[model samples]
Structures are given as structure tokens and as C-alpha cells.
Target: MDQVTKIANRLADVGGVVAVCLGGSRARGTHTPDSDFDLGLYYRPPLDTSALRVLAAELTGGAVEVTEPGGWGAWVDGGGWLTVDGARIDWIYRDLDRVYRIWQQCKAGLFEVGTQAGHPLGVYSHSYAGEVAMGRILADPTNELAALQEQIQASYPQPLRDSLVAHARWEVPFTLSLARKGVTRGDAFYIAGCLFRVAGLLAHALHAQAGCWVLNEKGAVQAAGQLPTAPANFSARAHALFGALGATPDELATAINDADQLAADVLDNLSPG
Candidate 1:
């Protein structure tokens, strides 16, 4: 159908490729005109790393920038837009069996119900489950928001669902601000990671409210009180981290506003103090 899919199929036809999976906003159907296709190339065991690298380099028409491995397998950025008969294409490659399972699962399920059966999905990722969990916590049968939360609540829970209300309301805004700053400063990886992290937080915040969980100002405040203190020396590093993310004051305000609304809505559904 699409050029990316065609290329993937072609690549799969190559001898060593075990499977070719798609990912990113494009795969999720949230792509804009400029979004590039993100593909994960999983090869059978005993892959010739050099050979694969050579093929990718040749295919991409630009140098490959490899992300440091996070234990399983390395992630490589395939630069250059591949033009097949005048159509532009850009993509990334992850070593087979080395990708994050949650990403794979979500990508697989994008087109159909049973698409993600054997792969890992964001089911266990706190970022993915955060908002949904929060919505569940604030269940109110009469409210429209409550109904929406109820719709997705059965699917999954945040990694730390009970603790999300407090953390998400504060941390998400902070992290979002930090992430934008990182993006501005060219800390793309940090920005991407923080964005995903905040998404999970928002998900939890929404779920807690919809589920009518123990989510109230008192509970939230208590959760805030329980936050682990950062060491004094780390304060500077923390600020630098924020700086790296290019966290802006305005962006922080927006995050805070969104988090607050989600929090207030959940609070409204509460059955009094």
C-alpha cells in the first residue's frame, strides 16, 4: 500500500530478516505530512551485525546514528530520505528482538484487533496506563467524562496507579516543560522519553477519576507529601536536566492547566471529604 510498507516487504524478502514491524506516530495514525515511517527490523538469531549495518547504510543514503543499547538491542537512526521513483521516505531501524515490547505491541495493534498477540505492548508501561488509570479512579456514572474513562479502564492499569494522582498533577507539567526545553536544545531522545512518560501520567490521572478510586485533594496532597526527596547536589543537575529539555515557563503552564483540569474533574466526582 504505502511506500514504507512496500520497502518493508522488500526488506523482509531478504534472507535474514525475521520480521518487519512499524512504529511511531505514523504507525499510530497520528502522522502529519512530515512524519517519517519508523520501522523495526528484527532478524533471526545470529544476525551479522556488520552486514545488516552495511545494508541499512546503503539503503538509507545517509549515515546511521545508533542509539546506545538499553540492555536488549541497539536502536539505529537511519538518516536520509529514500526516494523510490520520486516518493520520499525516511525510517529507523531497531535490531530484531531488541525493541521495547510495549512499542511493538501498540504498533502491531494499530491496524487490527489481534495484531499484537505475540508481541509486547504498552500494557505494562506506566506512561501508557497513567491517564486511563486516573480516569478510572474518578468514576461518576452521571458524567460524560466518567463514561469515557470507563470505556478504556478495563484494558490496563498504570504501573503505580494508586500513586499517580499526586505525581502526575505535579510531575507531568514539570517534565513536559523540561522535555520541550530538551527538544529546543537538541536533546531529542530526552524529549521523546519525557513525552511518553507524561502521556502515561496523564493516562493515570484520567483513569483514577473515572474509576472513582481514592482520588481527592487530601489524597493527592498526601501523595505529594510522600514524594522522595532529591539530594541537594542533584538540584543543580535537575535544573540542568530541565535546561537540557528546554522546559519553558509557558509550556509548563499549559501542562499544569491540563493536569489541573483532569485533577479537578476527578475531584468533582468524589463523594465528599
Candidate 2:
């Protein structure tokens, strides 16, 4: 068996593991040669982290620490990172019950964002649903994950889309307002941070407007640029705006204005007739 298949089988055999899935770029078919593998281990409560640690050690030929549930954070939960046969692999834990609950909440147009390491914009509650929607089931003996995936794939909830778009669009101006203050104080870093947040929010709005499930902020703006509802030259304009930032107050002000204009264009495109 291939290394991935072997790994998936071993993971499935671990106690409490309900399913194994291939997520991220690989599952989305957008991966390049160097893209790492993202394997999701969906489990019930009371997972066997010790067994997972043992498997990681055996595969990597070294000690690896696997976090207990919520070790990473509330939204991220916990998992491990490993290198097998020189290929990078990420094991992400997903609680089966939580995943389903989040999906139901999203269908009702309810979700929240929570702080999580490695996610500068925070983790979206609906992302749990997005991961399942975008992931491919590699091992689901009982078809548990498969059933959820089927339901998620059947349709992108209109309420969820409307909620995401409305919330993100509303944040754009609020975030820019903060950037405006930073610009007045000539705080380049603070201004830049606000601009990045605005960009992230705009990406969210664009993706939702297009009825796309964006998993995370990584490459999200460029990805949204490809969506049918995205404003013309969206990605290029965003990149240029970032590249144009300068240290001077005048320059910072110009950048903020440009960002606001870019945001306006996006919101305009999303506007109803």
C-alpha cells in the first residue's frame, strides 16, 4: 500500500477514530508538487491521543507530541505534525459531534469567529462545515463522515451564504475605521494590520457572495478573485495596495484611502439591483 493509504489505515484503527479524510489543497486538487498532506482524523469524545503519539513516533522514527483535545485551541482542537518518507503531513482533529452541530448552526445563519494560533483573522465556526464540504473521505468504514459530506455537498446553505457576506461586509468599514486612526498616528504596522484584516474580510464577503466555502484565509483573496461575483482585477488591486504602503503618514493615508476604495468596489459588486 502507498504511504498515505497505510497511514490512513493505521489512523482508522486507532480507538475512537470515526473517519479519515484528505483535506486542504490535496483534496481540493489545487496542490503543487511540494504541497503537504492534510489528513483529518474525525473522532468522537475521549480520543486516544497516546496511540496517536505512538503512531507518529513509529512513522517519523522519533518522539512526537500529539495534543489532547483542545490542546491546540477551542476552534482548532488538537493534532500532530509529522514528516514521513520526507513528505510533510498534518493530522487535524475534528470532533464528529461538534462538526455536525456547527453545520446545523451555519444552516441557520449562525456562526462565530474565535481566536486560534496560526489564524491571524481567527477561526470561523462555519469552517468546520467548509472542511467537510471540501474534504474527500479516505476511510469511512461506517460511512459516518461520508453521510455528513453528502449532506454538506448537496447544497451550500443560502442562509449561511447571506450571513457570511453580511457580517464580512460590515466588518470591512469598521476595520478600515481603525486603520484610519492608525494612519493619523503614523503607525505603519498598525495600519498594515488593519488593512490585512480588511482584505481578509473582503475575501470572505466575495467568497460568500459567490456561494463558495472558503476554508481559511491562506490564499483566500486570490481564490476569491476567481469567483464569479468578484470585482474586476480584485486580486491584483489588493496586492498592489499592499505593496504600495509606505512609512510616511501621507503615504499611509493614501494606502488607507486606496484600501477603502477597493473595499467599496467589492461591496458595490455585491450590491443587489
Candidate 3:
């Protein structure tokens, strides 16, 4: 069986695990084979502090770190956090009641979870909420995306609308998927960079639509939507990265392929079934 299935089975075997859900890029159908399995395991009541620590050690080979769940409210670096077969496996612990509520919201296409990664990390609504809502609006393909595209285009000055669509198509899916699974990979820094660009673009549109100011890479203030703020010094960094991305598209493709291969290798070794 696949590594994903293996993780799922292992999680199920654990006492108190109430439900297991596979999320992230794979579940979203946008994963490029290199993506890792983001397995979220909901346990009855909730794992105690000691249990959380033990699980983390077991998963990370004594290197699995633990971070207390603060504002976002989901325990991170808890047990079940490990790197297996070059793919990161994050075992997020959520109370069964909360998990059921999240599942209900997910099914209703709410796309908002209370806290991700078993921490107080709530879902960034502005990020994926628009995408999910837009997906529904454009479900008919009756010029729905186009209509929104036009509205955004006319409302925004230049490049912002096009950029948002581009990101909404490519970048946002990856971000939302990662956020969904509570697993993130920084092997390619560009993932974060791409998201930075998306935020800038969204801010631009939101500013035009709602009339607000957004901080940009250069700190040159611009009218952007009330979207999330861009990274402080991202603009200067993006130039080189874009050039690198263009030059190494194949390398990026290979990297993703390598991740998938690694996940496969681990799965082969573990043999879920």
C-alpha cells in the first residue's frame, strides 16, 4: 500500500484515535507526485500532555519537537510528527468534537477549521474562503470565473487582477492544501515566495474594491484590498527567485518527482497492508 495508507492505518491503530482524514495537496487533486501525506488524526477527548510528548519522540526518532498550542490552538510538533521516506508526516491532534465540527464545515464547503495542526491556528478565511466560494460560483462555467475576472480587472489598476487569477489557479491551491493538512515543505522556498506575491495581488484588489492601503515588498504603500499583508522584504527577494524558477522549471518538476519517489520508498519499506 502507499505511504499515505500506511500512516492512516498506524493512526487508526492508536488507542483513542477517533477519526483519520487525509488532506493536503493529494486530497485536493492538485498534488504533483512529490507532495507528502498530511494525515490528521482526531482522538477521543484529546491526548494528554505526556502522551503528546511520547508520540512526538516516537515519530521524530527522539528528534520530534513539540510546540505548545497557543492562539491557533492545535498542538504542533506533538507526537506523530516525523520525516519518513523524505516526506513529512504531521500527526495533528484535535479533539473528537472539534474534528467532527471541522468535518462538517469541510463538507459544507466552509473551508474554515478552528485551529490547524492541533494548535490555535485558525484557518485563514480570506485565503481559501474566496477560492472555495469562487469554485462554487464558477461551478457552472457559465462565464462565472470570467465575470469575476472582469470585475476584478476593471476594479483594479493593472497586473493585480491577472496576478490574483494566476495565483488563485496555481499558488493558492498549494497553500490551502498545505494549510488543510497542517504539513508544509520549505524545500522550495518559492512556495512561500509565490504566496507572498498572491497576498500582494489580493491586497491590491481588495484595496481597490474596499479602499484600503497595503504594504508591499518595497514598503512602497499601495492601495490594496484588505487581504493579508505581504512579507516585509519579499519584493527584492522575488526577482531572483522568479528568474531561478524560469530557469529550473524542470528541476522543480524533478524535485516533486523525487518527493513522490521517496514517499513510495517509505511505503514500500513499511508495507501498510
- Best prediction by TM-score: 2
Between candidates 2 and 3, the lDDT winner: 2
- On residues 1-273, what C-alpha lDDT tens digit does candidate 2 reach at each position? 278877998899999899999999999999988898999999997899999999999999999879998888888888999999889998999999999999999889898989999999889888899999999888898998999999998988888878877876778889888888877678999998998888888888887777789888899989988998888888998887779799888999999898999999988778441
Candidate ranking under TM-score, highest first, comes to 2, 1, 3
Query: Per-model C-alpha lDDT, please?
Result: 0.41, 0.88, 0.40
Model 2, CA-based lDDT:
0.88
Superposing every Cα of model 3 onto the true structure, what RMSD results?
18.5
Report the error of model 3 at residue 229, Å. Answer: 25
Q: Where does candidate 3 have its weakest 10-residue lDDT segment?
A: 132-141
Steric overlap count per candidate? 46, 0, 18
Local accuracy of candidate 1 as per-residue lDDT tens digits, 119-210: 22122332222232332121122243334335434543333343445555577667756655653355556664665455444433544433
- Flag regions of model 2 displaced more than 4 Å: 271-273
**What's the C-alpha lDDT at position 213 in model 2?**
90
